[model samples]
Target chain A: MKELSLNILDIVENSTKAKAELVEIEIIEDKTTLTVRITDDGSGMSEETLLSVTDPFYTTRTTRKVGMGIPLFRLAAEQTGGSLTITSHHIDDYPEEHGTVVNASFDKSHIDFTPLGDIVSTITTLIQGHPDVDFKFTHTVDDSSVSLDTRELREVLDDIPLDNFEVLLWIKDNLIEQYNKIKYK
Target chain B: MKSLAELQAIKERMKNKIVLREGTGDIRVVVGMATCGIAAGARPVLAAFVEEVSNAGLNDKVTVSQTGCVGYCQLEPIVEIYEAGKDKVTYIHMTADKAKEVVEKHLKGGKIVAEYTVTDDN
Candidate 1:
C-alpha cells in the first residue's frame, strides 16, 4: 500500500512535468475491491516505450528511472489478488497517439486506508504548488465519493500563479484538513 | 483557502527588496528533479538550497531551479553550478549538507570547491 502511493506520486510527477494541462486521478476502495487509476493528458509514449515501462531497469526518462515504480504498482495489485492494466492514446482519441492510463487493482479487504490520505495530500500539494497544472481527483470509499476540481480554484485566482510558498503550504494543509474531515473521526 | 491578497503582501515585500531575476544571474544552481532525482533525494537537496539561500538573504543573487533530466541517470541526485563567467560545474552524489557548503564557500567566498565537482576521478 505504501509503495502504491509512492508510485502514484512518481507517475503524477511525470504527468505534471510533461506539461499536462489536465490530470485525473481516481481511487476506489471497497471491502472487496481496491482500484487506482491515473490518467494524464501529457505527452504519451510510443509503443516501444510502453512495453519498456514495466521493466524495472528500462525508462525513457533521462534521470535514474529507478524503473521500479510501475513494477511495484503491478506487484502490489497482483499480490492482493488483482491486476494492472495500461492504455495510451494520442490527443485526438486515436489509439496510435500518445497519452496514458495506468490502472492497478488490489483486494481492498487486505489493504489499509491509513495511507490513502497521504496519497491524496501528495497530489493536492503538487497541484497546488504548480498552479500552472490542473488536477481532478475523485475518491470513493465503498459508496461515498468526493471530487476536487482545481479548475474552480483557478477561477478564484483568475488564472494567476499559485506558486507562492505560503499559498502552497495552505493548499497542502487544507487537503490534509479535508481528508481528515472525510476519513477520520 | 488562502487568497491573492496574501500573495499581494508577499509581492509588496518582494518589491521593497531584491527578487529573483530568471536567466540573468551570476550563479545558477539547477537541481535535477526527474523521477530518479526524487528517488535519490533531490527534493531535500533542492529544499536545502531554497532554505539556505533565503536564510542568507541571497535569494536575489542565487537562483534555484529544477530541470527534468540531464541525461545522467547514474548520477541521480546531480547538481549543476554555473557562475557568472566560469565553466559549468557538475556535482555528483550531492547531499543537503554538501549543498549548504557549496553555497557558503563557492557562492559566498568565490572559491571553486573542486573536490565536490564532477571530475575524472575522486
Candidate 2:
C-alpha cells in the first residue's frame, strides 16, 4: 500500500522531469477477482532504455537511480501475487511525441483495495490546477466504477490556485492521513 | 471499515479552522523533493521540519513545502527559505538534526545558520 503511493509520486516526478504536458493515470480494483493496476503516460523509454530501467544500476536522471522508485513498484506488485509491464517508444517515433506506459498489477486478495480510492483521489488532487497538464483517473471496486477527468473538473471545480511548494506538501500529508484513515477498514 | 460519516466530520473540522487564511503572513520553507533528495534522505528532513514547526506552535509563522528537481542534485537535501520581505536563503545537504537547528535558530530566532547557507563563500 505504501509502495503504491510512492509509485504514484515517483511517476509524477518523472512526468515533470519529462516536461510532459499531459499525463493519464488509471487505477482498477476488483474485490471478487482481486486485481489492481496503475498505468501512466509520460516519456516512454527507448527499447534499450526500457530494458535498462529494470536494472538496479540503470538510471536516466542524474538525480539518482530510477531503479529505486519504479523498480520497487514492480517488485511490490509481483510480491503481492501479480506482475508489472512497461511500454514506451523512442522520441522520434511519434509526431506529437510518446510517453511511457507503466502497468503494475497486484492481487487485491493478497493486499487491500479500500485504500486505493484515496490513492486515486490523492493523485487527482495533487495534479489539480496545472492547466498545462491533464490526468484521467479511473477506479473500479467490485463492479462499481468511479473515474475522474481532471480536464472536466477544471470546468466545474474552483481550483484554488496555489504555488508549487506548500500545496504539494499539504497534499502529501493529507494523502497519508486519508490513506491511513481508510486502509484498515 | 471507515465510514463516510467520519470523513465528513474531518472535512467539517478542517473547514472550521482552515489555517490558510488570506491575511496570514505565509512563510514558505521549500524542500527539494526530487529523486536525489528522496534518495539522500530528504523525506525525513521534510517531516522533521513539519513536526518541529507544528510542535513549536509555529504553524502560523511558517509553512513547510516541497519542490521537485531543484537542478542541484549534487546538493541532495536542499532547503530554500523564503521570507516575505527578504531574499531567499538556500541551504544544502540538510539532515533532520540540521533542520531542527534551522527552525530554532532561523525560524524562531530570525537568524540564519551560516554553516548551512549556500553563499558564494561556502
Candidate 3:
C-alpha cells in the first residue's frame, strides 16, 4: 500500500481472519524512527507457516497464489533502514500465549517511507467491520500519547451499536484530534 | 472534537431503523480487500461505499462489508453485490467514484449499472 495506514489496515485484517477476539495496535513515532506493532489473541501460526510467511509466494488462502502483505511490509521497512519481525506460537501448544505479534520499524525521515495516512479512518473501519472483535489502539509521538480501547467504549455504548454512523464519525474525529495534539506539540 | 452526545442522539433517533437494517438487510455489498486489492486502491472504494450508503440513507436495505480475496488479482478492487432474490453481480476494477455511482444507481435506484460489471466485456 502507498500509505502506512493502509498497510496497518491490511495487516490487522489477518488478525481478524485468525479469529482473534482481541487485537492491539500500537504506533510509536519518534525523532528517528516510526514503529508499528500489532498483537493479537488468535490462533497463532505453526513453526512451518511462520518460517515461510515472509515469502511472497506463501499463502494459506485458496483464492490466491501469493500473500504479499508481510513481504511487502518487510520490504518497506527494510528499504528505510528498519526491520520487521513476526513471532507466533501455535494455539494447541501455547494455549494462553497462542497468538501473533508483528513489529515493523522504519526510519521516520527516510525518503522512501510512506506517510502515515488517515489512521483514524483505518481504526474506525476495523471497529465497524469487525463488531465482534475488540481493538485497542495506542499512538505515541515523541513523549505524548493517546489510547482508545473498544472494551471501554463497549461499556459506555450499552445497547447502541459501535458502527453507528455518528459513533464512527466521533471516533474518527477523536483519534485525529488526539494524534494531532501530540504530533504538533 | 466531535461529541459522544451527538452519537447518542443519533442512536436514539435511529434505533428502530437500525434494528430493521441489522437483522434483515436484503442487499449485501462486499469489497475485496486482500493484498492485491489494497495495492490497487480498494480502501477508498470501501470508504466511499460507507459514506454513500450513509448519505443516501440506504443503510436500511444495504449492508456494506469486505472479503479477503476473490481469486482475481488482475481485477483488483472488485465489488460484489448480492440482492436477496437475485444472482450476485461482480464489478471489477472499481474506484471510489465508480463505487459512488454503484451506490447511486444499483443500490439506491435498484438499477444495475451494466457497464461496470465484470461480464460487460465478456
Name the top lDDT candidate. Answer: 3
Ordered by lDDT, highest first, the candidates read 3, 1, 2
List pairs with backbone clashes in candidate 3: none
lDDT of 3 by residue, A86-111 (tens): 99988988998899999999997889
| Native contact fraction (fnat) of model 2 | 0.06
Residue-by-residue lDDT tens digits, candidate 3, B1-42: 545566566667766665666576789999998888888988
Residue-wise lDDT of candidate 1 within B20-95, one digit each (tens)?
A: 4444456788887665665676666776775676676665577677776687756768999877668898988889
The lowest-lDDT stretch of 10 consecutive residues in candidate 2 chain B is B1-10
lDDT tens per residue, model 1, A78-179 = 777788898776444564445678898877676433234356445643553356878888877766776667776555554344544444454555556655
Candidate 2 residues A1-185, lDDT tens each?
25355456565666656666666666665553433343344556778888877776886656444446667666777776777787776566753657777777777667443233336334633463243566665555545554545455334323423222233344445445544544523
Residue range with the least summed lDDT across 10 consecutive positions in model 2 chain A: A156-165
Pairs clashing in candidate 1? Answer: A44-A98, A89-A97, A90-A97, A90-A98
Model 3 bad stretches (over 4 Å): A183-185, B3-7, B14-16, B19-23, B120-122
Name the docking class for model 3.
Answer: medium
- Model 1 chain B weakest lDDT span, ten residues long: B15-24
**Would you list the C-alpha lDDT of every candidate in the order shown?**
0.68, 0.62, 0.86
Candidate 3 structure lDDT: 0.86
TM-score of chain A of 2: 0.71
